[model samples]
Target: MTTAGTPTFDDRAVVLDGTLVVADLHVGRGTGGSLELPVGSNTELVERFTSLVDRHDPERVVVAGDLLHSFQTVPRPVDDTVAGFERACREAGARLVVVPGNHDTMLDAVWDGPTEAAARIGDTVVCHGHEEPPEQGDRYVIGHDHPTIEIEGQRRPCYLVGADQYRGSEVLMVPSFNALNAGVVVNEMRAGDFQSPLVTDTDELEPIVWDEQGRETLSFPPLGEFRRML
Candidate 1:
């Protein structure tokens, strides 16, 4: 979480046990392909990471997944985004480790960092959550749903946490790093409505809301109970 140094919330990037974890950079789908006139998402993304690197000074940065957006072809701008990302990490003095997401069928076409099926820092297992995560870990950190919540007509990115239904490990789902990708509003969604296994597999989702200052604002009740009150 970084405020003045980075955009509010760092868009849900979390630092735990020294290694910094961020997810769903989605670098070149026009930088927010769905937005009307997206520009410099590439620059903003790099700058956000740069600020994180400067603030945390972590030795390692794990891209939880989806560094690229286009699946069918390597969009020309995506290559530049990757290069700029590499440059940002290099300048910040942290090593970048990419864990492939479903969209990154050709992630290697651009990024050449330490790629892995998953990266473990202590008991925390970092995965993209497209498929099943690794079998042996006490906790899982993932992205992909791009969790969001709305209050007073304004949407804010959020983090979801709950105990795994089957595996028993704690799971933390980060919001998308892409600002324009306003994800599923957690308060209005059913647990099973989500695409991630860790999400759909359990109804224990608890929403952690952060303000524009990257400060924790509210921790909503678990979805199972919250749904009834809603």
Candidate 2:
């Protein structure tokens, strides 16, 4: 079960049972570009991630892709952040797994050899959500379209929970934990983009309509005005 209320500004952590999955962790702070925003410093990301590791004491930590802003060139600060993350994992005794996202893939790079992509542990398969869904077992977890919710005119990046069909397996699309990337609106996306059914209050996948921009438009009434409308 998810805790109610928006997460506190300083609280950049999400706990699912005893396992912790941190999304969009840009290790290097100052490395800004057209694809990346330097809103939160690299030091801040490390501090927050480390703090969560210490407090939650998760057995495994998953970096849901986009560990670095640009994988084409590993800047000095980016390298430092990677080292820092490794050190933290060692100290915390937690295993760290990295997935490749769109930003991490180098431009014009040929796929001649094996790429460091998906990771499978236990019953779940984790990967960055750019490519097609994996053909793993029943349950799948991925992060590609950082998802968000526009509730009562307020928009915040959130994890999208749903089921999809891929080789007779189920899929769950996790929202981007990255602060910079804009998420795909869940209620307004085209039905074809997603392989699984759109999850609603009824706990079933249904057809979702999309606007011109391909955002999923939700039909729920405004949050505060609901009581007044009644």
Candidate 3:
């Protein structure tokens, strides 16, 4: 069994106890500007999600936030993608919960399942991190920033973990689950650069990258010190 209050990082998702957590899916993202073209295929998302669910067999799957991309309307492909996620969870017998983010203005049109502004599991509260969470907990899991790190000119998606970050609570931030998002490079970012209120000190947060080839999670020094090395 997984330890309590600790997260198991994999790709863009985190497994906390029996819950599988992902954020910033941003479905229907590629249809906009020339620069916003899709980077990854939708089928790859379902395959990755199913692989995670099958491997972990979690009791619940929580989307931390930003399940959709367009702020105005829900497109047909977006709706289909949402259904694909739901079907995957249902088949695995895991309950799915969506914590709406700032971009999920039209989430209700596509998703009718359970949603929470802040969903709590054990001592951890999961939120989209676009705004202040309604409730408090010992630890907060959020996804608004979609943090990444650049090393040797190669950018990789990463997770940020900090202790006593907000209201004396530890904070865990995940990258965007959607592969299409290149993510915000945090090598030179400070706390003020982030949109999430949960992040107050960028220096205290450590960046963690999952090495898929090595089958290991590499934890780097806190951003405060790591920035100096880079």
Candidate achieving the largest lDDT? 3
For candidate 3, the 10 contiguous residues with the lowest summed lDDT are 31-40
Taking the tens digit of each residue's C-alpha lDDT, what string does model 2 give over 1-230? Answer: 12222211113334444456665654432433543335445566667678877877777676666666666565555555566666777799887666666665542231122234665545555566566645354445565555555556756555443344445444445555445556665545544555333221212222122231443433333222333343
Model 3 over residues 51-125: C-alpha lDDT tens digits?
A: 888888999999999998888877677776788889989999999999999998998899999998887888788
Question: TM-score ranking from best to worst?
Answer: 3, 1, 2
- How many clashes in candidate 2? 8
Residue ranges of candidate 2 with Cα displaced over 4 Å: 1-19, 26-40, 106-116, 133-135, 193-230
lDDT against true structure, model 1: 0.75
Alpha carbon RMSD to native, model 2: 8.9
Better of 1 and 3 by lDDT: 3
lDDT tens readout by residue for model 1, 155-218: 7788888876437777788899878676888776775677887765435888777665654557
In angstroms, give how far residue 184 of model 3 lies from its true place.
0.9
Better of 1 and 2 by TM-score: 1
Per-model TM values vs. the true structure? 0.86, 0.65, 0.94
| Model 1 stretches with alpha carbons more than 4 Å out | 1-10, 31-37, 200-203, 214-217
